[model samples]
Target: MTALPIHPDQRTPSDTSVPVSESFVSIQGEGKLTGVPSWFLRLAGCNLRCRWCDTPYASWEPESVSRPVDELCEEMRATGLRHAVLTGGEPMIFPQLLPLTERLHRMGVHITIETAGTVTRPGVRCHLMSLSPKLANSTPVGDPRDPSGKWAERHEHRRLNFASLNELIAGSPDRQIKFVVTGPDDLPEIESVLARVDGWKPDDIILMPEGVTVPDPDEVAWVVEACRTRGWRYGDRLHIRLFGDTKGT
Candidate 1:
């Protein structure tokens, strides 16, 4: 996706032209900086199809709407918010996101990226990087039994790639590993990734529940106990509880 051109008058659209699904202002409801005012930019496509995806509107087919980047940036600035969260169907898919984010930085906005931990780029300098590593429970594209079997099968080749995790984490300070636990079955995968990524203290890892609309209190308690045992922290999806997973808060 490419950024949209600015109109000479400079009155731009609310969204960006870089193939956006939606954009608006909301509190950062997840990750390290939860409960912070942040402008949300949801991109239009994703490489992986997790079973419990909450924002299918954006992830399933975001390419259908192409927004101009100038308009999108203007939309963000108008919000009067100091923070911006760049999220996706895999936002890294849009090569132009670098320029979009760079402009945001120039505006003194603190930027955060919520990604699936597969792709990487050097220029999209975000202040906070929330990378959720895909697990086996995350359906690979094209696996028919996957809840969205039809969609997954068609996009299997474009499944999320873990090729950039190393570079992204090398010098990142305001970053965290967020793992969505689906019952007890998901813990092993988290352990495996942690073991591979040495020096990632448990304090830097956040275990969250997998519910889309709302997190179960029981699950949160279980995760908290597990984190206590492992020395990690438990993160709850604040938006899901406060807004029931609806868009635009």
Candidate 2:
């Protein structure tokens, strides 16, 4: 499945492009579309540095190779897959994504954008807007991943943009809001944030346990109970379990 949707890859510098991390055909491991077969386009570069970001290859040190969107579209057409996931270190950061998503959608591909909900691009179309809003737990404060404590400060400042978050939710009816929950303490912050954001029902929210490896039984039970009590959905990273966090799954 080289034909599956993925970040653009270019042959020449003249080609219009976005930095590509990788691409793969895999079951969606998280969010509302969990267990769905989907092609993933992992674009590189992220504005925020989360302490537990699984794909540091795509975020902390993104691929330097800029890939052509036109080439990617050609491959996508050949894949014969209806679902195309435009994921990234943060796909919304690339304006080139407008054309990329437009072409894929026009090809009759059901586009699903996996974004952190910090950025928004108007005029983009997708069947599903899988918004994984970074919570306070994502801040890299004092985490060894950011040894200099540089990204720690910057990540905290850029993690949440309510203006963009609201726009993403308000613009799409077929969208899911997800938050990675680290512990029971994260519950109150989620409640407070949702109260401020516009246009989402309790059912629209999804609470995901934070881990790449199989989470402990206690964590799973806690998240399930949290969802049961709050009218939210529980999200799991099935791909991680199925593929062991490896690339091109």
Candidate 3:
């Protein structure tokens, strides 16, 4: 992978214990496994901060609770669920996920790693590599979320790592490129991002409406239309619709 000057805080803490924000049993709300029942392992800490980050507790001001992989795996086994999602605050930052997924795979659990596609995990094994690359709109330039008003530049520079994204795409046998589209014009930017990343198929691309809560119907329709015209899949924030963006499904 090519070198990039990622900010110190942007990198996951190189500690033995995996930092967990929250873990729960929720339906697969996005991508191909939209309605399937699955266990969500929402790890804490993120490299980049999004302007409209839905899980601010896991990112903007992360709630860190150290939990070991064995303990986390035990929680998954207790769930009695077959499908599992290793999601984040950018889960890729936490290397413990590599071993965590490894353990889950041995237990016959189908794992999905939801990431921003900025960090590459060569040994990361999963049934699905859900890649959600943050777009330009996600930058917190003048956003109040960033108290120092510095993440705009920091996040913008660290957000899109094509080299790492390409490695991640190449490593995973099954993968999806999910983009959180906030406007109609984001299509071009999305297309441009796809061009830089190598070996992504048309079916692997998914477009999700950008919002913490339920998005406007008109906004959702535009995303649907974009998907129809481009032959990409439309991803819905079902959790937001059903639970109104609350924690733990």
Q: For residues 33-57, what per-residue lDDT tens digits would candidate 3 score against the true structure?
A: 8888999989889999998888889
TM-scores of the models, in the given order? 0.83, 0.90, 0.90
**Candidate 3: which pairs clash?**
none
Which ranges in model 3 have alpha carbons more than 4 Å from their true place? Answer: 1-16
Which candidate comes out best when scored by lDDT? 3
How well is each residue in 1-249 modelled by candidate 2, as lDDT tens digits? Answer: 112233332122335688888977878887777787888889989888888988788898887477788888877777777888988789999878777876786688888888898997776767777888788888888887788999989988888889998887766657888899999999999988888788777787999888878888875898899999989998877888888878886
Which runs in model 2 stand beyond 4 Å of their true positions?
1-14
The local distance difference test score of each candidate is 0.72, 0.81, 0.83
lDDT of 1 at 229: 96
Candidate 1 lDDT, tens digit per residue, 125-146? 5777787886666664454445
